[model samples]
Target: MRSPAPEREGDDTLVWNVACPTRPSSVPGVAMAGFSDRGRLPEGQRLIPHPAVTLVLDFGPAPPVVDAADGRRHRGSLVAGLGLGGALWARGDDLACVQVRLSPVTAGAALGVRPDELEGAVVPLDALWGRDAARIGERLGEAASWEERFALTDALLARRCAAATPANAVDPEVNRAWDRLVASRGRARVERLADEVGWSRKRLWSRFRAQVGMGPKRAAKLVRFDHAAHRLAAGHDTARVAAEGGYTDQSHLHRDVVAFTGVTPTGVARASFLTVDETAWPTLPLGGVNAGKTV
Candidate 1:
């Protein structure tokens, strides 16, 4: 199904046509959203850092462009690692693409590289997948409808997963730690995770960083920030969100919001990135309890 996405570029409200897949992906830990804009795309659309790895397949009349905080500009299809640190802005016109959010546990297998390699960086898809990236983009452009595009993307991911070697598999203990963090909405303690996973704190931290692209504490914080940000976007007061999100106080929440998003709580509430979640991610599929469920 397709609908107009609610978006805001600062004070100016903008809309982009958003499309969702008819069915969930056959691959576990994967969710997809398709976006198209025949008119001019919104400028300065800040990308909020989420806990999942993001893969964007651009196949519109013109490729999309992402400007980073360091004055680096990335064009065309790209994959961003988990915890982007809130410094990326997307700008383009006539944009069309399928954006996939992958659980870090599954990202290594699907991307043919450890998630750590992509940490906090946006790399062109071609850099990782070589010519295969261009071929997939071409197929997406040639697809007759959004459903076809979704199917094509899903199949590609499934193929990649199937071809993954033993070297790419995530350690089961690391997966358990991630699941616990998600289940607790990022309130899980790193020491407790290490205990539950039967590993020393130091060991768990190292494995998680190597496999999931971030340490346990940082990952948990990102997950917590994601939950709080969504609640703020839903119009909840900062005090209430802070209490429910396990913050020590309103000030603690404010610091975290600023640290991750470069914005205050009110600013995050008005952010187009968070506002569009309802239309773009109805399943809310970012590594919940059923993260690795397959079709």
Candidate 2:
């Protein structure tokens, strides 16, 4: 069967949709996207947040200039850390990129940088993977087709992961905490997680923060908010989604949406950047990982 193509191209964005990658099982949590801006991109920024860490590679005439809330404008292929209520303002001309999402546990190994090191930051891939990042960018840009690019990326990550040492591994307890958070759809209690892991709350907080980049509570909140946002996009009513997502009320949901994306729930539901998730990342279910497995 043929892979899917972009649904539509507008004056601002040109997206080339491809089939999900079928590669080594070592990296089931990975997903890929290929897209470009049609000639000229419109003004304004987009707030992008997901359960997994984001890696982007630029190959078009103009690479994306993604300005995060901290006022840092990062260019070229880069890794976007887990955003905790962070908004990224992006703008460029003739922009194209292949965006990858790796389960946070595997992300650190493939990028050779711990997740905590990327908290609240958007960094150039060169800063993390150095020469390897440069080589990957060149190879991806030179690939003849979308399928080839996706395959190349998957193989590269899988190889890197296989060769990584124990230093790159996450703490088993911390890894479990993350899995529970995702499985619970961010509803897992931090205290319960601490007990489950046989650690005190403070210890759990310190370790998880150092490994996952965000404290357990914040990670849960981010995961829960992501679920609610996608549900809103799926055309659910605001009140129903809020209640189902465990929000105290519609107002609480509104506050979170505003906090995370700097926009109303309705605006989040209409976000094209988010609307593409289903098509571009078919295998990436909610929680963004296989809970039972580590990395």
Candidate 3:
């Protein structure tokens, strides 16, 4: 899949060769995509935040570098938490990597860490996975094709899930609440979610935050923003998108678009990060359990 060439001056014209696995992963809630740059990578490519944990395994000749709004720089393989609010920029050349998106419901088990620990943060994979991180990078670099890389990644994630301890398990109630929120596209009420889960509002909020890395309300907003951003990218008018996307008014939608992405709705409509989805991940569910499910 090819993204439109970036508009910035002096940036390379990037053409990405995107590949998807021939079959679904054995592990649920895990999705992967492979991207190889046909030319030098675009400079300072902004990344729009989504509502799922992201893991990038870089095995290109040169490692990619990500710069955060806070002025921190991360290189090579890394994991980014949900809801970063469009504060990250990726810059590199000769990029080749398999990107994985993990649903919050299963991220803890697959990552061997509480999702909450990663909120709004990007960490080097080796920091969490130790020597195994380096080993996987080496193996991925040695793989002969994208298909082999996908298979290797799926096997690694499955092993991690299988080895997760009880402590990494998410509560069934939390899972249910997440499902409802996704199904509603973040239009679901928190009080109603609490009641449905048979828990008080306070209890539900605490548990969801602890297990999912953010409060229920924040998660809902992120999910809602994700939906609206895509519609805008599809060329829908802002007023119509606001009306049907659970916003009280066009202004409300504008605020959200700016809040989550640090850009106006118009700007977001043109974002390469979002526009690329049409081809790179045409069939993926954005924020659900099986999100990022490529062809």
Candidate 4:
């Protein structure tokens, strides 16, 4: 049987209110979700903690080449972006209006993609799955209408999962290093990490590519930068943020802030709700809480 799910929209962003379909009864989870946003080159692209399974409803215009796990650029068909809960690094004027967002575990299981492979990995939207562009459009067109999208989403997810491949796991060393950086809010050294992991720089880089989807140094920078952003959002001074996040100085932090988010710390804090989705943007409340559920 089908159910009615609430829908919400915004200037460049829209989120549908829905319950997580497959989450544990006691453990909070997110069911299938839908989102549509017009892409604008926002400051730095950020990463999310959990992975996602997404479907591109339609690419309004031209396609964009996003960074991939292998660091290779893959050209996609959709004038849209679809990302699973993986690491993404973006620094360009790529734009699109996209749809579909799913919880990490549900998405991974439904799509047959592993959770760890998505950690810190970024691939062109199309690289992960090659679907008939027209078919994808058809699904989106139907799903966007009324609440039927949920059922359509279910079928679509099932199909994708049926044809999907098993995802690989992230490297232990690379993951450990990433965890430390994230826990420290972006403070650590590759040399020290390498010594702890007992892997050479070359080996570490390779592992990062395979597991985390980025090089160690780049990932570290992102971790530190992400921490800086959270600090700024939470009302930290620019200089203090720089010092705490391990930047050489406030100027460096400022540059990174501009380079990554296209806004100053104060600017980020000033806004009530953020617009551009920082690919790896950190959220407050320590862990994370699932919001909005209907009785």
lDDT of 1 by residue, 42-147 (tens): 4647777888888999999989999865577899999988866355788888899999988889998999987898767888999999999999999999999999
TM-score of 2: 0.88
Q: Report the C-alpha lDDT of model 2 over 29-125, residue by residue, as the tens digit.
A: 5666666554444574475577778888777666788777777777888888876228677777777677777767667777777778887588888
Give the residue spans of candidate 2 off by over 4 A.
1-19, 23-25, 38-40, 286-295
Q: Write the per-residue lDDT of candidate 3 for residues 164-237, one digit (tens) a residue.
A: 99988889889888878777888998779999999999999999999989999998998898889888878899
Which portions of model 1 show Cα errors greater than 4 Å? 5-14, 38-42, 285-295
Candidate 1 at residue 173, lDDT? Answer: 94
- Judging by lDDT against the true structure, name the best candidate: 1
The alpha-carbon lDDT assigned to residue 141 of candidate 4 equals 58
Task: State each candidate's clash count.
Answer: 0, 0, 0, 19
- Model 4 agreement with the true structure over 47-113: per-residue lDDT tens digits: 3222223433443244444454345543433211112223333323333323344433334434345
Worst 10 residues of 1 by lDDT: 286-295
Over all chains combined, what TM-score does candidate 4 have? 0.50
Error of 3 at 183 (Å): 1.2
The lowest-lDDT stretch of 10 consecutive residues in candidate 3 is 286-295
Model 2's C-alpha root-mean-square deviation from the true structure amounts to: 2.8
Using Cα atoms with residue i matched to residue i, what is each candidate's TM-score against the true structure? 0.93, 0.88, 0.91, 0.50
